[model samples]
Target: MRRLIGAAVVGLGIELVVLPLWLLPRSPAWGLLLIPLTLLTTPFWSLLHEAIHGSLVRDRRANDAWGRVLAIGYGAPFALLKSGHLLHHRYSRTERERTEIYATGRWASHAPGYYLRLFGGLYLAEVASVLLALLPERGWAALVRRTDRPDTITGLLFDRVRRRFLTQFRLDASAVVAVHLAAFLAYGRYGWMLVAALAGRGLLISLADNAYHYGTRLDASLEALNLRLPRPLETFVLAFNLHSVHHRHPGLPWHELRTAFAADGDEFHDDWFAAVGKQLRGPLPAGTLIASSPGVRRH
Candidate 1:
């Protein structure tokens, strides 16, 4: 309940506080807002992200409910975001068992960097297609559900077409549309820039996320949320910055993370990069200077 309230308050605060500055009259300071807003956007995503993984809710349904709300915040059509993330958990920190899941800097020079960055960009796209083909759609509602999928039935990923349509809903998505509307009337041309800054914010979020949990497991309590990271970057990213710990203890809520970290047992902390390197063959799918042979792909 606290996290839910936090999400509502934080979401509104983001649009209210950050949007205005971006919409304000032209000034050199507007550029600075990008850095801050980029930072601001991280917590918003982290809180809701933790919520979706069931770490923030006592009841599983509540987790599902909030996850839907989070999806709306990101614009709903992201099937890969929901599914891809869960799949990463299913197969964590193994290069040979899972290709391209880890980014120890061992990627082939030939790998399509742009396309690969877009979620298991290769594997899950094929999975989504096969899933759509094979998964049963019962009844008429199911028949009409060009968007529905096994994940929706089991509450994994949101439906397929709904994900796309709702995600792509330009300003018409009721709550989100209202947001864009306010910015449009207020900032006019500059409103788009404010919105565009969120893109940079997403970049930051992804980078920090990779930095925090990079090739680690979240099978126990608070592991992902407790890993060490630079202190200066912590608050800008919010308390949930203790990512490995949070992944393990998903229900801890953003506010409780620090206390949880301090109170956690010996297992809660780790150097994320080093954890994966122990038995890892060669460099990770991404490469690291410490490996034996960078290109020696293991089977």
Candidate 2:
């Protein structure tokens, strides 16, 4: 409950603080303030992630409702994301499924360019996902059939899992549109800052997410890279820094993750920036990081 309140407060602060600061009559100081304010939205995205996993709340209906609201703030459809995310959990680290969670195409495996694309166009990737979700079911189906690929999030958005929750999808879409329209009206000429904030959110989200499982091999145990982050960030993102624990015990609530990790700490990686730095340099050693964990041999 306290974590939820913190997320709500920061999410609201993004609108109240960042938007107005960006709109304030041209000033270098206000521009500087916008940087951290925009980046501060990372936890809000984390809340959306918790909701997508259905671990944010105990009640199913309430969880889905909050998922929709958070998705609107992230500018993605809740139903679409929830569907893709379930598939991701089922097929993590595989060529066919990891793309749903991270942009792991051929280019993403190569040198410094991978990090460039990961951070530089993370928001554009979200925009593409939104556009894909907007396609009619049949239209999206046709596109998938033409490509003969089900590896990307855009392709996964065409999955049939969402058919059962079509109404929720529409509601999520409507909420996103309404939120954007309201922001536009409120910011007027400087409404573009809202769009910039969305991009900023995407960059931070991808950085944090990539830090989790970016360089793992397909056959790795648990298939996750748990980094050691600062105490404040770890608390703020609700222990997502311990990515392996969350993936291993997906049913655990955010607050419970730390206790769970303490019991099976050997199975997780805590190499700090090792994985991210290795991936940034070039291709990563498959499962090498995970192999270092006690009793967890690399496949």
Candidate 3:
């Protein structure tokens, strides 16, 4: 009951805030509104995270329904998000993982350009990859060859990728397109604001993503890095900054995270701003390499 009510209120609030922002004028001051709006909508991802973990609600279907709704607001396909997230939890810090959200610089180059991509470029790359993923198999295969499976390509076409494209991608893609098209038709003149809102949200999400895993080692037990946020922001992000706790207790719901942290906060707490600063200042510190490379084709 608590989780459902809280998620409903937050979801409603994001829609209410975003709808009006689309009607605002396209001026410098108006553009600034996207920053707070981005913060306001950040919890949608948190709720989706809880849903993916099956902790948003006890009913499995209810969790998936809410997750799909929340993901639509953030413009992601829930099925793809679920698969990648599950892999994240299972592999934690290993290179076999398709997504870079939990990557530890273990298998790839972590140079300046790599950090730059992590900061913002990767979000744009995801949008492009999604479009490519929508293409016919032969067309996409021609563009992204069988031999070279880069992060962008692998993320969208890994193991269950075909199933996602056939079912969830087919249905969810239509819904996502319809929503954006409606928004464009209804408020085309203010389209810049919509773009700004999405870009701002992407920037903040990237910041949060880098802050969670930066400076951590590749060992599963030691990989997670927790950032201590203020009480309200911590609640808003559903204790995501307390990532180590989440990694440790994947079963706990958002509301109960504080209690778990109270009992074990010291184990993972790190300076939040300092961690963010570390990633932005330069490339990720070299991580200890794990054997069994992701590229070795199985016979």
Candidate 4:
């Protein structure tokens, strides 16, 4: 509970209070603030991730309530973020969710899309998806019909988009849009600072999202890189650097991840930054790296 509240206060405080004050002066120094603010995203996201997995609190309602608040501050609806993440756990390394691999004879055409998604476009797409909440029920059904495929992430997502879920999605998305819009208005002439900060957040998140699973075996549903980090830094990010443990025990809270890793005799695949850096080598041909077994292995 303390962690959840602390995360909420710090994350929302930076977005709502600190950012507006920095921009109010309209000074060149505003750019300097972006670095630390951007770096703070990892911990903020870690806490939000706890809520998504229903481990932020004991009560389901309270968990989702906190998740919605954090997700709004993060600039996307909670439902959207939760749905996408759960889908990643379900479809990871499959054709639909493998962000760093390309099919034969298609690397050239897909390269632009892959790079865009890796840098900042993924978060931008998440934020922009709020617009879909404006569509009527019939419209959503039509969209599902047009885009759904059994093997694709979108299909699975749309399959779960019943009326109750859609209602909740619309409500949370409205809150997201309203909060950010008000933040921009508050920033006024210095709104560009907010824009830069969001872009930086997006870049950081997109780059890190795939680092855990990049080039891992496609057949292993729960495989992930357990990247090493300095102890202090790992604690700060809520032990999220221990990604393989989280994949194996999705219901475990952030506080328990380190112990779980130790108990399982897990090993780190690489330093966190080194694993993230590997992504810059660009998309690899599908099946370029193969694992002999279904459990965790370094790519």
Candidate 5:
């Protein structure tokens, strides 16, 4: 209940108040709010992530209901985010999931894509994916079939997409589009502000998303960096900085991740900000790093 309420307050506050205030003619002062507002997305996404893992609330149905609500405000469909996240756990560090890896001698070719994903491209892709919902059932299925590979992310998502799932996905996706469209319309002449805010949110999310897993061992599904942060800051982010601990104990709620990390006697691989910075070094050849490689430690 607290998580749901907090998410609602923060999500609605941004949508209803902060954004609209920015559009006022004399709202230059309102621009200051954008910094904290953008930063809030970190914890906002953490809350949605909790719902995704069924830890936001004990009641599964209620949890999912709140998750869809939060996800809609976050600018994507809950089902799509949930599927992709679960698949990340299932396929982490595999070729299908290694965002920071490239084939030998392909670094130059892969660098642009890697940098794009590092910035804001990942979230933009998620927002754009709502277009799939517009397709007819057969068209959606055919597209998925053409793109799906058993070892790939598309395959992972497609494998879980039944008729009922598709119906729900489409409904949730339509809701997402509707909500954002309404926001855009409300922004009127200041619509560019909404776009800029979303771009900032996307940049923050994309930059942090892969920080924990960047340059980790291939096929090490449970591996991630336990990036360090001060205790207060870590708590502020809902203990999400303890990535390796959460991966090892996915069922543990965010509040319990710190306890799990301490109980496991694990070490932080790098400072949180530093680890995120390391991604800027770009892609490396696969197999260049091992599970316990020094590179992983450095990251």
Candidate 6:
């Protein structure tokens, strides 16, 4: 969580510092800063993503409790994210149900209008997804399974949050609306800074990550990476890009991913890259999908 907090501080502070500068009437410089700062949010969202998955916390509930705080900032539903992500882990490459690979031919990735969605104005996108996830008995049923632990905190966690969101948003459950509301109160047309810079950059990060990690590989384990980012870039994405180690030991928690990688750097450096070499841009290694760990069960 410390790593995530640090990234959030920087990612958000960049905006907080500039917003005040902009209140002084039209300043081109503030707008300029806003343009790129929005770009950085993609990475910011990436950091939030890993943190929500419990990597940031040594304790699961400790991680989970605060995960909602993160979700609230995004105006996102934790249940929605959890429902999809768990499905991704369960069936990373399966068709129709694959969140990673949108075989919907939407592969013509990121464009300008796509970026405008940072305005917190994209309606029905996520709502449709959450609803569709409930359409199949698989979707409805798996979502229900989360409630099996009635004796524990998970019950209150899922039901309360989900019910509150369901009642509040109804069919119009876009975090974008809250974003717009904040924008109206905060800065009018320019208030999009929060969404554009923060969420826009966030979407960029997700697309890049999705394509780099998911869009390319048909196989799950082969796509894993000890993704060593360049030094300065680490501040933007945090260490969350080091994805492979986390998968190897999901129970190991977030703080330990780097330590675990450090302990095995030599081995991953020597062999792991080539193992995943098939998924890269230029090179095409001829082979079937393979994961280094025989340990991960398909769910």
Runs of candidate 6 exceeding 4 Å displacement: 2-28, 57-62, 96-124, 127-176, 191-199, 212-223, 253-255, 265-299
What does the lDDT read for residue 108 in candidate 4?
77
Which residue pairs show backbone clashes in model 3?
A: none
lDDT values of the candidates?
Answer: 0.46, 0.63, 0.60, 0.82, 0.81, 0.46
Which model scores highest in lDDT? 4
- Model 6, range 98-200, lDDT digits (tens) per residue? 2223322333352233333323323224423334323443543455576545222333434433554443333233443454355445655565554455555
lDDT of 2 by residue, 1-299 (tens): 54684657565555745556453555433544556657666667667778888887878888887777667767778887777667667767665645223333453545454565567455555545555546676775687566547544445555443456655666667766676677667666665766676678777766555556665556343666567777787887777777788778888877888888788753446555665564454445343344344433222
Give the count of colliding residue pairs in each prediction: 28, 0, 0, 0, 0, 6
**TM-score of predicted model 2?**
0.78
> 1-299, model 4: which lDDT tens digit per residue?
66556756676776666767664566656557657867888888998898889988899998899888888889988888888899888888776777787766667777887789899988999999899888988888888788786446885676565444888888888998888888888777778878888998999899999999887887576878999999999998989999989999999998899999889998998999999989887888876767466566654
Model 3 residue 250 distance off true place after TM-score fit, in angstroms: 1.2
Q: Write the per-residue lDDT of candidate 3 for residues 154-227, one digit (tens) a residue.
A: 53444455544446655765666667666655445666766776777666666666566654545353356667
Task: List TM-scores for all candidates, in order.
Answer: 0.53, 0.78, 0.76, 0.92, 0.92, 0.57
**Candidate 6 to truth, TM:** 0.57
Residue 16 lDDT in model 6? 52
When 4 and 6 are scored with lDDT, the better candidate is 4
Models, CA RMSD each: 8.8, 4.5, 6.4, 2.1, 2.4, 8.7
TM-score, predicted candidate 3 vs. hidden true structure? 0.76
Residue 227's lDDT in candidate 6: 49
Best by TM-score: 4
Better of 1 and 3 by lDDT: 3
lDDT measured at residue 282 in model 5 versus the true structure, 0 to 100? 92
Judging by TM-score, tell me the better candidate of 3 and 5.
Answer: 5
TM-score winner between 1 and 2, please give it. 2
